[model samples]
Target: MNPELLIAFLASTAGAATPLVLAATGELVAERAGVLNLGLEGMMLVGAVMGFSVTLASGNGGLGLLAAMGAGALMALLFAFLVLTLQTNQVATGLALTLFGVGLSAFIGRGLVGQTVAPLRKLAFPVLSDLPFVGPLLFRFDAMVYASLLLTVAVGWMLARTRLGLLVRAVGESPHSAHAIGFHVIALRYGAVMFGGAMAGLAGAYMSMALTPMWVEGMTAGRGWIALALVVFATWKPRGVVLGSYLFGGVTVLQFHGQGFGLAVPSEFLSMLPYLATIAVLVYICRDPKTILLNKPLSLGQSFRAD
Candidate 1:
């Protein structure tokens, strides 16, 4: 491969992985607190539409990003209330949330279909951004790519070294015990779930505003499911989430360029590459029962009540 082409490929891979990093990192946090949110796809769709609509209307990418996160958080609050307060089944409520987000975003965005908004402008640092190959590969990405990486590091450090991380981990590992010790397990889980939603929303916004810069109904195209699988693939670790996301992102990017490499494969099979990689990783991971048993949050997917 030519050096310039290779640089572009790596850069595209980073961009492709950004949303997954954002979503999976958020999901990792929520799961660390023992909440399983399956409505990620819905939240992403809602966020995508909300962000695009807001940005198009306001002409501000920042506000659009904020709206996306807010929309996602609101959806998550609904999920949290159902599972935490009402004690509904976590899996069922999450699935319902996804369905609701799908329909709601479509309804809200009905008028905005086929509309185009400017992609989020990439940030530049004077001389840094002008450097030959390094500039385009690293300095040319938009704000969200850097934000995702920072978020991952912060989460990892918190989980491993901070008191708050200890408490969250405690809640996830044994909510009843944490509750007995006055940890307010329900409230903690609520916060975690909402955070996850906001991140999912951010991911969606990236898709609409940066990746393709257009709204199509269901633009998320199952990236939410891929993010979910990513958490499992990462064994719920923050760093692992980044690595796994990039791996999937590379697969996704590669598929798009597969024909260019003269591989003689059909476009359809190339398109399936990302999903196939996801399933293959999952199956490979599941083959080791100990990996799942040791890393999975003990109370994950279970409803908890203060009573």
Candidate 2:
């Protein structure tokens, strides 16, 4: 590949990594608070359809994006209410949520299967976007790309350095202990879940309105599931999510682009790479009981009721 092509490929990889980065980081936060949300996939699909629907009506991508986030958060809040407040099984409730989102999005987006969207534009710094190879590599990216990277940093900093992050960590480690220390464990988990939902929604909007630039039924595919797996790959660390997401995105993009390089492979085979990679990573990460005991959220995928 030429320098220009290489630069473009890297840029595209970064762009493709954005949504995964956002989604993974958000999941990390929620899991850190001892709330495992498997509804991420469904939440993101709803966000994509709703984001596109709203953007079409109002002609405002930003507002549409905000609406998408809200939509995801609302679903997450519902899950929180069911699992946290009602003491339902987190895994079962989350799976049901995913099913509901998928059906609802399909129904509402049936009419929007073939529609265009004005994607969010990237802002390039003056003189920065014109620099040498670095320009194309870094400066030429959509707004969401920057937002994803920044969010990773912000969430990582919060988890590692801030008071709230410490509290969130404490909650994940032991809700009973946290409550003993007067921390509002359930509320903190709720907040974390909602934030995760918002991020997942933004990721969905990026799919419908940015990556594809059109509304498509089930456009998110299984990206949300991959994001869920990404939390494990990141060891539930916010910072590690950034690196892990890009690795997955790179593999995903490569699967399509590999054909361009004249690799003799079936398209279906390439399509399977994303999910396969996720399974492989999850197995590797969870293979060790000690590692999970040390790093995995102690109360992950568990229901907590304050007594």
Candidate 3:
């Protein structure tokens, strides 16, 4: 392949992976704290619409992202109240959250359906962005791309190195012990859930404001499900999430590349490639129960009561 084409492919792969990385990382954090937030799809949808609307109205990408985060957190708060406070079933509440987000986003974005906003521009590092080959491959992405990378690193470091990380993991592994040791399991889970929501929202905003810059019904197209699968694929590790996101991103981009190469297959099949790949990967990872039991948070999806 020509250098230019290779660079473009690499760039697109990073862009494609950014949202997944962001959303999966957030889910990783929550799961590590013993909270299973299945409302990621809903949160991403709400964030995408809200982010686009806010950016269009305010002409500020940053504020739009903030709005998206706020919207996501609010959605997460509802889930938290139900699952944590009311002690409702996490899986059911999460499914309901996704349904709510889909309908609510469609209603809110009805008028803004065809509208567009200026896509966020790439941030060129002074000398770095000008280098041969390396510049386009590394330094030529928008802020969110870089933010996702940093977020992954930060989460990994925190989980492996910090006291707070230890507490979060402890809560996920065994809330009773964490609580016995004076950690507030409920409150910590709340913070983790909210953080996950905020990240999912930002992932949605990235879709509207950066990736596509327009609103459409169900625009997330099950990326939220992919992100959930990624958390499992990564074995709940932050670094694994990054690798898995990029791997899936490559799978997504390969469809277009395949078409470019003059493949005879229908475009629809190409489109299904990513989802197909997701299922394959999940089956491969889950075929062995020991692999899952060793990595999965022990108390995930379980409600904890201080009493």
lDDT of 2 by residue, 1-307 (tens): 6676667667777877888998888889999999989999999999888899999889999988998999999989999999988999999998999999999999989888778977788788899999999887888778889888889889888988999999999999899999998999989999999999999898998888888888888888899999988888878877778888888888788776776667799988988888889988878877897765657888888777888
TM-score (C-alpha, index-matched) for candidate 3: 0.98
TM-score quality measure for candidate 1: 0.98
lDDT preference between candidates 1 and 2, better one: 1
- Which residues of candidate 2, in runs, are more than 4 Å off? none
Best by lDDT: 3
Tens digits of lDDT, candidate 1, 1-307: 6777778778989999999999999999999999999999999999999999999999999999999999999999999999989999999998999999999999999999888999988999899999998899889999899999999999999999999899889899999999998999998999999999999999999999999998899999999999999999989999899999999999898877776666788888889999999999989988989987768999998777776
lDDT of 1 at 89: 90
By lDDT, rank the candidates, best first. 3, 1, 2
* Cα TM-score of candidate 2: 0.96
True-structure lDDT of candidate 1? 0.93
Measured with C-alpha atoms, the lDDT of residue 249 in candidate 2 is 85
Candidate 2 structure lDDT: 0.87
Which ranges in model 1 have alpha carbons more than 4 Å from their true place? none
lDDT for 103 (candidate 1): 99
